[model samples]
Target chain A: MYRYDEFDERFVRERVAQFRDQVNRRLSGALTEEEFRPLRLQNGLYLQLHAYMLRIAIPYGVLSSQQLCQLAVIADKYDRGYGHFTTRTNLQFNWPKLKDAPDILDLLADVQMHCIQTSGNDIRNVTADQFAGVAGDEIEDPRPVAELIRQWSSLHPEFSFLPRKFKIAVIASQADRAVMKSHDVGIRIVRNKAGESGYEIFAGGGLGRTPMVGKRVREFLPKGQLLAYLEALLRVYNLEGRRDNKFKARIKILVHEIGIDAFRDRVEAEFARADAFSDDENAELARISAQFEVRNYEKLSARSETFEAARKSDPAFAEWVAHSLFAHKVDGYAAVTISLKPVGGVPGDMTSDQMRFFADLTDRFSLGELRVTHAQNLVLPNVKQDDLHALWRELGKAGLATPNVGLVTDIISCPGLDYCALATARSIPIAQAISNRFADKARQDEIGPLQIKISGCINACGHHHVGHIGILGLEKRGQESYQITLGGDPTENMAIGELLGPGLAAGDVPAAIERIVGVYLDKRADGETFIETVKRLGVSEFKAAFLAGAQNEAA
Target chain B: MKLLDRNGFRTDDFSRAGADGAARLDAVIVPFADLPSTAARAGKRLGVDIPNTVTVEQLAPHFEKLALIGIAFPASTDGRGFSLGRRLRRAGFKGLLRASGPLIPDQFPYALACGFDEIELPDASAARQPESQWLQALGAITLPYQRGYARPSSIFEQRRQARKEAAHG
Candidate 1:
């Protein structure tokens, strides 16, 4: 909801110009592909399997209707009339030409967006909880701090070439919707005994070839010193992180190699050495926080007559409300999650027309803003309860009203071997098969609150390491094989999933998942979710079911 | 090798110290490992060329005796030198700080903002990215977002001053 100031505008424009010049230099053979690769990657241009992909950052997952419309326009004009929203809450146009990337960046700059630091070994797009301001349990809005960080880290002189990519996530609520603990640096807003706001800082949490939850470094860092502390932490990691092996270069690996206490002591020493915090930083924080102030809300009754009538009249409407609606901090408002995962559809993919439709609905129903959730869905953070029925109706007309927010059908998947150059197997088709197997809405509801994440490779872009039912696709011999992991959690109690026995063949994946779900159904107690059932029944039973399924397919 | 400053191409006044260890009156640059032996032979304007891995604490005690500190980048992508430059300045190194390696024009602004006085590029890098590119890249963004550095005044302070003026006027 924050508008770009003159400085921000000029900064993006200059970046675009610089990238354009780089592109020209590449075209003229003044720079080799190896020389140009990192430059383009820092600007979020990737040479994918078939073509170039341009990923644009939706800073902190927040987007205005105007910006959404512009994205739709860019998709139609430059891409193949579609864009895929990533698990990082960014969007990828998979078919942009290298020549057209600068033009696309120019278009994004017009909408206060750019793809800077979206990829590369730099401090990347800072993420926060999608429901920051409107969440019922929020201590403070995390967006202001996220934005301040975005500004400070953008094209940072001392940190542009880190040994590995750095991700920072901020969360204000205890729910941990942003998966804060799995980031390189996680900041949780808290109040001390004196009721003054501060931060609980965690460092070195990530998911990839190696998965480790971040360790708490500072118990209570004053809010004013956020940037200073982050600078100190990054300076330590930048100079000291391993660089000999690319796979072992993440800050999490550094923290693991040398214990968290040593890492914290180094960071603290660096913090004491540098004069990072100053009056100018406080003023900057104030300037940023002023932009995130809550807008005027009308004092409407908490209970809406139209909403109640619609719920009574329509069973489908009630079902959607049950699954999609989230409680808002405000009495008369609610946050509405529009599922991007429809049955048998590719996860996180949206056509240009669907994007335009959502933009229009955003203007009409919610405030003029919506947010992209890390779960690969869109959220209207300020939908009025009075407008819920009408909103549901409009969403249904556009095929956006799928009541599967946390259901089995709401899968998070990556663009595997089909698009990504590094993937060994296809992830989208596998996600589709599983979603179709559980397409029955009643069955999905019966299963209840399952998170199925599928990643095609070990890079873990799809976050298979944290899913309740995690599926990692690997190439065994030549054919595609899928490995299942159970009971992984991404919440405040973050834990990596363990491998459930051996891998299964591609055809047996859906049936294996079915058997796993069947086992859960048989073993679950009253109102127990999939995760709880897995925890109760243990992985041995699910492993037996999966092995049986795999054997049956083999026979 | 080529020397570049904010105004573009510049002449290099410093020469590398020879193995003979003879006294020189003008500026002479010596490797950090050779500093102990070269200190006696060098003149008042002594320069120490350090590897990127060398920390500020290692260089602090010798700061008063040197006129320049050159941080070696090895490769353009190895950004440890940038952080090293900033750390040296933050630790109150008022002497000249030079980033030496094969870096690009795109990195010129970062080099300057991180408190480097000049960039010493290998001949190949200088040939690929000429002086004009470096000069243009220096002015790529006239302002920056950081504070408490030795660079130009931040946009944050500028915006605050503007707000204050508006309020008073």
Candidate 2:
């Protein structure tokens, strides 16, 4: 959790006042809708179908218990008593009034949070591995660098109005939990052969209408040159990125058209011109890193007698063992994932009361440290093994202790037609239906690790493109249909899912998913996971099972 | 229509001296259609010969030639022209900048920060309302290529080094 310095605090305060004036002008009819639209968007306010939506940045998905509590207060005070965590690792208030937005921003500023650059054609909220600090395989924690980038890109003068939105992701681990390869700019912290820590930079990766895996632009950029390298990259894109058509404006398209070699040449040339690193920037990053230091853990025995006894007696704790836990870097501690996807509940959503409870739990069991994973679930990174049972009991009451952290029913979904104006069909209902279909805990456990991602539209907010079984909601004529894709994964071995034959109507989508999962169950070898089955069987088999009925109807 | 220069003076300052102690000069008030070409031709014909200027309904088209431009803020908080002034400076057009027509002293610092060299207050009463009150307030004055310009030792690099030192120390 990086604390705000004097400069950071002042910047956010001034930005809030600036937006407050803009809102006042718009409300007074001094600014037209066309004129005020971009201004409002730059401040993270959107005019959705029903009400104004405010997307708040949770920098690199890190949050203190106090910050989470503040967010809960914002939801209760201004929104519909709950907030939706996004795939980008930020949160959105689905229902905010246009007038109260400034007040909400003011409140956010008080807690060192803002909606700045959360949307619009500017550098967006930087995302990174949620378990950056505590992950056992990490080279270093990447949040300090992420915080530096956050500060540098905030309301940047030249890059504020880019051809399209830019997204950057950082990963400090070899496991690639942050999905760094699927971002506009992906940075991985690595140690060179000489044992000096540096950054391995990737460019031109994105997911949207056109999906691409980023190419390596720099093999090993020195740690101090991160800002200079970024400046060169953005400068080239800002000047040369296509603004003629909205669809063809992303850096990925530019990279594809020019070829990665030529793009690399140009970026390197630009980097050479601006090769200097300033002392001020280094000093600032140093200050930021100091704020992110992990709390010292007490030396303890490797074995936990209490935890072993509880797990032996409790079946619920046993179930939690199979799904909800991950090995921590320290001995006798574990990272506990709090699943928001209770069967038949909305994905990535937490009620106000639940948020407050999470705040308290993080303080008590996790050393006031919490992380929002890219999967839209919360994590308690350093929970002692002895405290797991008590924490699980408290979480069970809040509907968060589902014991299905990475299991089949823990679906990733977006607020599709229910909240998004661009959505052609509803996504929440489909997610709910699928969750209900697999509501039985025994059935879910039997199915094993299956990621079912649903997106309301092609925007892939639900991360449908990276799900084991991806369901994309589309509208044909006046009816809703779901186009399914198979074999997408967002882990270290990332791959975009391939679409099956024809889409299924809304009524048939759930059954179609059941048929596909059933096909996996039948065809899988002994002790194989869903992804393994998909990898071995490929899409043709799933396609045959998914579209068999549609083919029959046509015949 | 009174055509004012960047220094709040009439165009007659270098041409015909003020008659009856009131500034008057030969100025062409062009319509929106003829503003650009006419301003260019006027700049060519005048060639710094006499104190001659052209005024138009909009300033965006003639930003390159006019040493001094006047923007009618129309009403209070009409910020389209404020953007115009900023763009002019960002585009590297450093000349006499004037903001007139319904503009007040409250927006003085913003106008100045946006590259307006001079501001034409409506009258003496508007000008007398404590210019210092708004003058001292700082405005965001950033270079056009601030993000693009990569100096060898930048703020981000400095911050990074500082962090390393603190961590190791």
Candidate 3:
């Protein structure tokens, strides 16, 4: 993880002071609520349904043990002793006082963190793969580049107030974990024919009211020209993106309207003209790269006898290893996933005590660092193979050792109508119900890698658009209606899921999901995943099964 | 509307010119739509106030003809004007460039850095966020991380200089 230098520290301190003044002005009647709204939103404070919610940016989803400790302290002191980690890999304190926001920001700054650009139309926190450096199939670690972008886009003079919120996600691995194709700009670090690592830039990809898989504007952009290329793309979007309707203001809509060919031409022209990058930027990248480089790993055997013995002794530990462990680039090291989804718990909510315990575990087992996944889980990116059993035991003590990483029970949900002012229906209860229904580990394992994502509203904050099984909750005629979409893949083959027939009542969602799963299990071959089964059987079979279940449930 | 620059409040030296050339103030701000019909006045400081919709190419040719260019930000959240300002500067507009809108004081540094020599705030906005607040807001962030803007020194440049000094020292 990159530590904040003096410049970065001073920058955050000033920003906190600036926001403090703004909050004061807002309270003093010097600034109207309308005037103060964007100011507060820029600093990640939102006026939610019952109270103000403060979102803290976990930059690139990476956190040090010390930072985690600070987050726990803040949660205990300012919030209701818990913070909900969002799908963006950021954390939201649901009940922070409006006046205490400045204090919270000051606390975040102490840990080299701040909530700047977490919300609003500004270029939001640039997210990268949680397994960036540690992943087995990575082309290169994207954290250094992600950090450079974070600096470049932070309080950007020319682009602070874009037509709409823009999100950029970078993924270096061939296997997409960061939902790259569904961001405003998705950068896939790729190698050219010459075997030099470069970026494949995808623009106009976003998922909100209008879901779009990004269109590739540039096939291969030199790694050196990353900032310049990004600036050119943003400049085109900033100048040309529609401001007529708020819903149609995203770069996706602009790209969709003008076509990618014309958009590419304009961007290429702008790139030719704009002197966006300098030698200083290259130097900064070098400094950032040095920070991400880990040179302290000891070479060890790939197989660990202790790990084998632990697995033989405990079946639960063995299951956890199969479900939660990811292949590490280094020998004897595995990336361990600490699942936040215990059965019937809120998808991403972690209590203050859990934060402290998780931090202590990270300090002991995983090089004192952890990464928050977009799927609402924490990842210990460098756990030794021998320590897996010990870590599992520690995690089990805190109910963190859930052997359902990509299974149906491991759901991604939003703070819907219960907290979010924008939400029309409840999502947490729906998530809880589904999790309880699929509490059986064997059943979830049988379901096999089904992503059940729920959103309280059409904003898709829960990323319902990309889930294998997306459930969007909408309020229709004062009744909560849940709409199901099948085969919504967020991987390299990204597509918005198709709507399967009419909406179901909120109470009937789990039954509908069960029928869908039942259909999948019935039709699936020996090794077919839920998505693979859906693809093979088509949406029509699932729809037939769903309708049949709905009729039976109504009876 | 109060016209403000790096200096406090300044008198408006420009005005809008009509097609007939009968309605001309000291320095005229010709609207983009009216530019084709309105003949350019020699010795008169001609300026164009462009909407966010206008492209840089549409206004590039007039860079030499205009003494000042005003970018209209209809709303504070609509940031097209910021890009427009940078484009105008890149297009070699040597004269005064102004951001005219109901912008907040928080945007003072952005406006200056984006090549805006002055800000023309609506009377109500000016009354709400006075010159003192704007001045205070300008220094809120001591250094910006960006390059190629109106700022004297960006943080990137400063850091590079410091690094060089440390090597020598």
What TM-score would each prediction reach against the true structure? 0.97, 0.82, 0.97
Per-model lDDT: 0.89, 0.76, 0.88
Task: For candidate 1, write residues B34-118 as lDDT tens digits.
Answer: 7866553333588999998998888898888888999999877888888888888888899899999988888888888889999
Residues A299-341 of candidate 3 have per-residue lDDT tens digits of 8899999999999998888888898988999999999887889
TM-score of chain A of 3: 0.98
Candidate 3: global Cα-lDDT?
0.88
* Native contacts conserved, per model: 0.54, 0.06, 0.79
Select the stronger candidate by DockQ from 2 and 3. 3
Give one digit per residue, the lDDT tens place, for model 1 in A26-116. Answer: 8877666777888999999999999999999988999999999999999999999999999999999999999999999999998999999
- Identify the candidate with maximal DockQ: 3
Cα lDDT, model 2, residue B33:
40
Please state how well chain A of candidate 1 matches the true chain A, as a TM-score. Answer: 0.98
Interface RMSD over true interface Cα atoms for each candidate: 1.5, 8.6, 1.1
Clashing pairs in 1: none
Q: What digit string (tens of lDDT, one per residue) describes model 2 on residues A1-555?
A: 788765567768877877887676667665456556767888888889899899999999988888899989999999989999999989999999988998999899888989998998889999999887777888878888898888878866456666789999989887888878888999999999999888999988877778788889899998778988897788677656776788999999999999989999988976886647555556566777878886677676778898989999998888887788888888889888888888898988888888899999999999998999889899898899999999989988776788888888889998999999989899999989988988998888889999999999887888888899888998898889889999988876879999987777877777888888889889999999999999998888888887886676457
- TM-score for model 2? 0.82
Score chain A of each prediction against the true chain A by TM-score and list the results.
0.98, 0.97, 0.98
Worst 10 residues of 1 chain B by lDDT: B17-26
